[model samples]
Target: MNNIKKSQLFWASCLALLVTSLSFGIRAGILGKLGTDFQLTATELGTITATAFWGFPLAVVIGGFIVDAIGMKRLLVMAFIFHLLGIVLTIFAQGYWTLFISTLLIGIANGTVEAACNPLVATIYPDNKTTKLNHFHLWFPGGIFLGTLIVILFNSIGLSWQIQVAIMIVPTLVYGYLFSKLDFPVTERVASGVSTATMYKSVTSPLFIFMFICMFGTAITELFTGQWIDVLLKNVTDNAILILTLTTGVMVIGRGLAEPIVHRFSPQGVLLISAILAALGLYLLSTLTGNAIYFAAFIFGLGVCYFWPTMLGFVAENIPKSGALGLNLMGGAGMFAVSVYTIFMGGFYDRLILKKLPAGANEADYLSAAPGTEMANLLNEAKNAAGPEVLQATLVIPIILVVAFTGLVIYMKNKKKEALTH
Candidate 1:
């Protein structure tokens, strides 16, 4: 790439990173704060999260088509509309339904930002797709680090969560303004002479089907952590700011080191190791307390650091024609899976554990601030309502099932190719 194009790409990556940082950095804190304010049940909290991912399922379809039709310039601008409206509605949202609606808008905006930018990044750094993709994505976690700081600032100053959400507008407008100046690549679906039918044919083949499995696993594993760390810390410490600082700080440490680790393991090998550690960490996280819980979260973060970028890189390498359309579609599918899992998680949390966890004890607060066994009544309630088994199931969904299959696919493909060469 020329000097001018490289510079533009760097700025564009920054724009994408900033927007993503805003979304992830403050999202979990936002959910915890909402639960505190509204007395939301765990199930309700899941619904709130679902709204964000719900946009993922549909937005990719919309973004995939429109990003090409209208161009990323307009689509990128439209992406911010979701965030702006979402923040406004969130500020005014008093009830569960209203909250869901606003969150859905926010989810769509998150989806659009990615849908537009992933393709733009691919076009910008076409040669080094994996490295550029990893570097480009360094911003998502970087944004999370920033968002945590912002959360600390607002909480220390006694600001409302709505105001914290309103901060998203900064990146939104900044990226929207920056995107206005650049040109983005067209979607491969449009550029390739393939119709929807032909595209569908290729995508549904064994390769695409396996890729979908990887995407779903990657999505849920990363999101479940990002969306819940606040809740995990909330259960123990009333100091929300302190908790955000510690958990996010540690996670930042893990992600910051991902680039070097990824080079050593390769994305797939890294994912394999991370998946095993994550499932164990999640189970340990739910069951343990004090140092144990905190330690487990760190382990979980270490495993998750590579999942997102590795999954994206895997698809990009495998599906040459997908461009932004394919990446966004996979991402959308992954998030949609998250939405479904969140509902089940909430239901399990509400129906089984909350009902039994002692009288006059707020379940939302209890889950948000996952207490240790010292809270004997709540502990017994948690034990009776559910057990380590249920928690283990949720954490291992990706590793136990999805990773197992993905491993098989990798093995078989390699063996088949080796035989042909021989």
Candidate 2:
């Protein structure tokens, strides 16, 4: 502990996470541009986006298994290499497959950063795992806020998407340098002398499995909507990216103040409340129009702000024996679910818009129609109608979460009572 540079390592992890999140934010901002430039459909764009989610689980689950053996520094190095390659590839991406591969690389980098950092933070701050983890995770939405602002700025100035992506390299280099200079401590599992078999067993426990299932809902409720905000709300709002920016901005504040909040409510209680707010927010966004969308965005942000870190923290604190594997598996499962859901949402959106088209009209007709022409206007109206419907359909996720988190709260309460009685 004395030899390790805890502050430097933790901040470096934040910087690495910033890089990961900037990719998400920037990608969200550029999806429209990519679609137009490459002549891609909603489904194709979704596939490219889904690669990032799917690739995340792949790296994270594998990294979780091997992080203790390979060392945190090594994983950080892998993240750096992958990030550099991915960003470069994306800058030069010609079409679908190239975009898919590049985004996958970035996703892998993102997951590796989480694999190394989550356990690293837990090990370093043994006493304040949940609160500090929340604090550490603040950079996620913080970076997204910054990334969205950058996109807005760059777009206003007529800059290329390549330039928007290249900005990521600055933070990537800094994190790589900072991580290289630090000495990392062993994971909490290793430090506590928790055996590998015990960690494995704990992750497979009923409690862990329940949380794993719940993660699918929580993650999609937050991430899928965030990633697709520009598309989902484009028709409903004048600037959908602002909704993303505002949502992430709210998240930055919420996560920053998470210590007091988590102290007051307990992580489970907070999650339960978050799910309710998120459900309400999504429903409002689907049904509302005009300036009301910003209000809904604020609510959505508050609901999801604590979700990721709090989920990780709960596991770290209550299921201490599960170690890094549990944290990574939770994250992996969430991302994997989002990957599958993204494709489904994309296809669903396409179908909805198609149904809105007049009889015998198809996507090709809308695509070939000249801008502002009657056919184009019809297509725009259909998109406007379809976008909000997608959001309306997604409301089911958080509604379900309300029930699941309620169960979790009840189950945790009973566990506490049983512990005190024993």
- Candidate 1's residue-wise lDDT over 127-160, tens digit each? 5566666666667766776787888788889997
**lDDT (Cα, 0-100) at 304 in candidate 2:** 91
Show the colliding residue pairs in model 2.
none
Model 1 spans > 4 angstroms off: 187-198, 236-263, 358-390, 401-422
Tens-place lDDT per residue, model 2, 1-422, is 65247777888899999999999999998998898788778899999999999889999999999998988899999999999999999999999999999999999999999989999989989899999899999999988889889999999999999999999999999998888887778788987899999999999999999999999998999899999999888887767999999999999999989989999999999999999999999988888889989999999999899999999999999999999999999999999999999999999998998999998788876866878899889987988889989988999999999999899899999999999999
Report residue 127 deviation for candidate 1 (angstroms).
2.1
- As a TM-score, model 1 comes out at 0.84
Colliding pairs, model 1: 21-143, 234-369, 235-368, 235-369, 235-370
Residue ranges of candidate 2 with Cα displaced over 4 Å: 2-4
Least accurate 10 contiguous residues by lDDT in model 1 = 236-245
